[model samples]
Target: MSTGHTSVPEVLDALKDVTYPAGKEQLISAARQAGAGDEVVKALRGMPAEQYAGRAEVARSVRVDPDSDPGTDAGRRAGQARRGGKPGLSQHLREEPRTPIQEEFDR
Candidate 1:
């Protein structure tokens, strides 16, 4: 568990400019590079091993609401604003055509 409360925005801010579908190592590296404090780093390190498609997924995985603004309903609306109506990275991945090798492997 984290020693301090690390907000979702804090983590996202720390990971600014990070590429999507990032692995744990890359996320941690980005956080460290951004000079994230111990709590933020600890939260990221404790996340389950998986590919993260976007900040929202990472926020959810870390148990922080990407839309929450500390202590208000305003946070809910803020999340939509943050996304700017664009689809998440996972959505793009889902629509992407599988490579020939991948398609063959599935067969």
Candidate 2:
């Protein structure tokens, strides 16, 4: 039942490129038990090679500085204008002076 090797360097070699955050050992164990070596190989089998350019560790981009003005009045107004950006054609028509033909058609 045993391969007769104490430490399978091949298994560790298979895990060379596999990386994860701390405190996710349960998932790693599950993958091994389920016959998948690690998350990298599991993901690579499911995804196209072109879609992934390999992995690297990087800091989070969403965490901005405390000194940055994220919700100032200018920021709020800009966000509001962006959210309500569609021009109102009906309101524009109401503001415009009517032509003689348009006046006749209205009556």
**Poorly placed runs, candidate 2 (over 4 Å):** 6-8, 22-107
- Candidate 2: tens digits of C-alpha lDDT, residues 1-107: 33232122333343344444312243234336546544333322322212211122111111112124244455454554445432321111112345799999999
Candidate 1 lDDT tens digits, 1-107: 54456777798899998999898789999999999988788778767678888887887666443333343355434553454443332211123345799999999
Compute the lDDT of residue 64 as modeled in candidate 2.
18
By summed lDDT, which 10 consecutive residues of candidate 1 come out lowest?
86-95
**TM-score winner among the candidates?**
1
* Model 1, residue 101: C-alpha shift (Å): 48
The lowest-lDDT stretch of 10 consecutive residues in candidate 2 is: 57-66
How good is model 1 by TM-score? 0.56
Query: Residue pairs in steric clash, candidate 1?
Result: none
Candidate 1: count the clashes: 0
